[model samples]
Each structure stands twice: as structure tokens, then as C-alpha cells.
Target chain A: MYLAKIYVTYKPSILDPQGVVIKSALERLDYQGIESVTQGKYFQVQLSGADEAAVAKEVEAFVEALLINHNTETYTYDLTEI
Target chain B: MYLAKIYVTYKPSILDPQGVVIKSALERLDYQGIESVTQGKYFQVQLSGADEAAVAKEVEAFVEALLINHNTETYTYDLTEI
Candidate 1:
């Protein structure tokens, strides 16, 4: 099986309330010098295939088609054999 | 400055509806051979510190204190100079 480690985050133009909340939470917790916090979704997908190049292409297409909403978010992922 | 690439995923015991939905969506799109989907939060934290070891220690403490809830999710992070 192949494991895809995906990281998806909001575009710079988009407002991320979750990130904002996390920033404030850090401030409240006395974690000084936190320059910034940008948050997104991370996923681990297990694919039942063996062909490396073919799987990478399919995964990219899959990401572009369903995993990312280009209107607000951007995503990047890596596939590794496991 | 240092950049901490953090990934926080739900505990295996927790129910992940979002992942379930994504799997269904992928299946609907005919992306066959997807064994499973698991989702979590990813963050890139910019910290205003120079010392690598001290920064890593602080980042760990920061993650434990505010970035992760010991109740339902687990987190792992990497600190890189940036």
C-alpha cells in the first residue's frame, strides 16, 4: 500500500478563524514570541496500489478534483510506499 | 526564525466524519483502490527564536499546552530553521 501524507491549508486571501483562535490561545497560555499561526487539514490516505508513477498521477488528479477547493484552499501531498 | 510543521490527527478511537465523507466522495469519483482516509490538522508555525534546541523545547511545551488537546487528538511537529 502507498501512504499519502497530505497537507491542505487556506489561501493567503482567505480568513482562517481557527488559526486566529489558535494564535490567541497561545498568547493566553504565555507562549511568547509566536510570530504567526496558519492552520490547515492534514490527511494520511492508504491507497491499495503498487505502481509508483501511476499512483502519483492518479493521486494528483484526485487531489485537484476532490481534495481541494481552489476557491479558498490549497493542498500539497507526498506519497510513500509503506 | 524557526518554522514548525505540525500535524495533529484524531485518536484512532475517535469518529472522523470528515474523512468518511472524503472517502465516499472519492469512491463516487471512481478513484478506485482507496483503502482508507484519515484526516487531521496541519499547521506551519513561525516562531521568533534563534536557538534551535531551546526553540524545539518551547515548541513541544507549546504544543502540549495549547496546540493539542490530550483528550481526543495526538500531535507531532518538526522544527526547522527558516
Candidate 2:
């Protein structure tokens, strides 16, 4: 089996209001020296396949098709054997 | 400056409905060999501090105080100089 750790984040040009809100909240709570915050989505997926190559291929296809909005976000993944 | 890559995830004992939904959706879409799915929150935080150790200490305190629910979620972070 292979495990894929995927992260999907907004493009650099995209404005992340949630992140802005979080930063403000942290400041309000008296957390100092916080420059910025960016929020993203993380997923861990387990797949059973014949080999690492095949499993990685499947993960890439499924992640692109179902996990993210290609127009606004980009995704990266690390596949590890389990 | 430091970049803290943080991840907040539900405890293993907790049931993740969102993950279940995603797995079902993937199956419906004919994606195979899916064993399980777990969804989590990711954050990239920029902090300015005198040193790595100090920044890490601040991150730990703030993350524990605000980023996660102690009963259901757990968090881990990687701090890197930027």
C-alpha cells in the first residue's frame, strides 16, 4: 500500500481572506511578530496497488480530478510506501 | 524570519465524515484501490523572532491556544528559517 500526503493551496495571486482573518485574530490575542498566515487543505489517502508507480499515477489522476479547483488552487503530494 | 508549516488533524479515534464522503465520491467516480481518506487543515505562518527557538516557542503556544480543539484535534509543525 501507498500513502499520499497531499496539500492544496490557493495560488499566490489569490487573496486569502481566511488567512487574513486568522492573522488579525492572532494579533488580537497578543501573538507578536506574526507576519502572515496562509490556510490550505491537507489530505492523507491510502491506496492499494501493485507497485509505487501505479499507485502514484492513480493518486495524481484522482487528486487533479476531484481534490482541487485548478483555476484557483494548486496541489502537491508526497507518496510513501506503507 | 521563520516559516511554520502546521497541520491539524482529527484524532484517530474520531470519525471523519468529510473523509468518508470524499472516499465515496472517489469510488463513485471509478477510482480504485482506495483504502481510506483523512482530511486535515494546513497552515503556513510567517513569524519574525530573534531566533528559531524563540519562534518555535511562540508557534507552539499560539497553535495550542487557537488553532485546534484539544479534545478532537492534534497538531504538528515544522519550523524553518526563511
Top TM-score prediction, candidate number: 2
lDDT of 1 by residue, A43-68 (tens): 88899888988888888888889888
**Candidate 2 residue pairs that clash:** none
**Which digits, one per residue and each the tens of the lDDT, describe model 2 over residues B2-76?**
999999989999998899999999999999999999999999999988788889999999999989999999988
Which RMSD values do the candidates have, in order? 1.5, 1.1
Q: Fnat of the models, one by one?
A: 0.96, 0.95
Model 1 C-alpha lDDT per residue in residues B1-82, reported as the tens digit of each score: 9999999998999988888999999999999899999889898889998799988898889888777889999988988888
**What value does the lDDT take at residue B72 in candidate 1?**
92
> Residue A24 lDDT in model 1?
90
Per-residue error for B18 in candidate 1, Å, reads 1.8
- The estimated TM-scores of all candidates read 0.92, 0.96
Candidate 2's displacement at residue B16, Å, is 0.4
> How well does candidate 1 match the true structure in TM-score terms?
0.92
